[model samples]
Target: MARLNLWRWGVFGLAGLYFLVPLAASVVFTVDVPGQGLTVDAYTQIVGTGGFGSSLLLSLELALATIAVVLLLMVPAMVALRLGAPKLRPVVEVVCSLPLVVPPIAFVAGIVTVLKWGPEHLSRTPLFQTFVAIQNPDFPVVLVLAYVVMALPFVYRALDAGLRAIDVPTLVEAARSCGASWPQALVQAVLPNLRGALLNASFLTLALVLGEFTVAQLLGFRPFAVWIVNVSGSQAQLSVAVSVMSLLVTWLLLLVLAGFGGRSRTTSRG
Candidate 1:
């Protein structure tokens, strides 16, 4: 037992170093200047930096939109598949997981082709406006669409695990017997049980949007990740500083989410 405990601690120490060493190095790089012993100028300048605020705000907006849209589409579909057509569940799972198999470069290339095609061929038609509107750089609804695709596998897995853990049909039937509609049952009964899964999916989608570079960069849109890279060319310290701060912020958000989820679960139980 003592030998096993020692080995577990050793493994944990190694894993902690593996993740923490790089983060420590980045912190040093940001704060430790050659002549100057330590300074926080890098962190201080983040807000004043060009495009920093807008890019971060844009990324948050994209993440929120992605979470809402993906949940709105996926939750109902998954529930229906589980209840009405269990056999089709595998087919739906495969379709959702296709994004994982597809390379980002290929995915972005396809998007680029479609965008170009819309303007070239569909010009002078009502659908042309539809294409033009989605590409608006201010919000770039196209990126939200792309993110929804990229997020499918994670969202599906989270929701599926949640659904499998709970008896969906039984819950729905009970709710229906009590004079609740399908939507009402889902909203009041089904979603409460799915609290944890929903949080996981939302957090994963947010992380993906914040960290993703290829799709946003290729689409010629400037979000937080691209702005960080752009900042690196001019101010390396500030870039690393931004990266560290973003990491901390993400961790803080996760903790808050976890706390909120826990409280909700406790309240539901009570």
Candidate 2:
């Protein structure tokens, strides 16, 4: 068993190194180019330019906003499914996971076309206008929507597992016995139990959103990914720096989320 464990660790380390080799090469290449000779010029160039900063903030905002909206939609939807229609679980799960089946580029294209034409037909109505406004014309609303859709599966699965772990039937009965309403039981009991799941979903969503480039590029959003692409073309050094910064930011957000999640889990257990 010890030998087996050692073999497994060896395999895992090799796999990790294989994945990290490209990044290592990039860092070495950025530093070792003759005249440059181990300088921090790349980092300085990326940070000195205002564009990278603006794009970083935009990406952060986009991820946070997407997470908030997704949580709002997912939590109640999950609760309702869990409490009201257990039989429809399969259907609900399929619907939420549909984004994974569809090609992201195709999804973005379809959404963008519909949104573009929607305003023309529905221009006179306030509701239509509001809808159109929410589907941001400049940034990629389609891409953000795609992120939300992709995130649903993770969020739903996590919450579903959390709900199952809590012994929902007992909690519901206890809440009812104490004269607590359905909403009260859900808010005060179920939600607390699901905090770790929610935190996991949020961090995963953040990581996806931060690194996303295809949808943002396809939809014409000036997000960090797009900025990185543009910078890479004009200045490779600056682009590397910006990428490093973005990585750091992502790591920081993940750490914060994990910390809070640990506390919430401890509180829930206590």
TM-score, every prediction: 0.97, 0.89
| Winning candidate number (TM-score) | 1
* Tens-digit lDDT track of model 2 for 1-270: 999999999999999999788778777766666775787677667767867777887888888878988999988887887778889999988998887788878887887787678778888888686655665744545556778987887777777777777777678778878888988987887787788778878987898889888777776777888889887887776677677678878899899889988887678677
Pairing residues by index, what is the TM-score of model 1?
0.97
Q: Quick one: how many clashes does candidate 2 have?
A: 0
Tell me the spans in candidate 2 whose CA falls farther than 4 Å from its real position. 135-143, 265-270
Which 10 successive residues of model 1 have the least lDDT summed?
248-257
Candidate 2 Cα lDDT to native: 0.79
Question: 1-270 in candidate 1: lDDT tens per residue?
Answer: 999999999999999999999999999999999999899998999989999889989998999999999999999999999899999988999999999999999999999999999888989889999998998989999999999999999999999999999999999999999999989999998999899899999989989998889999999999999999988998889999999998987788778878988898888788
RMSD to the native, candidate 1?
1.2
Residue 174 Cα positional deviation in candidate 2, in Å, after optimal superposition:
1.4
lDDT of each: 0.94, 0.79
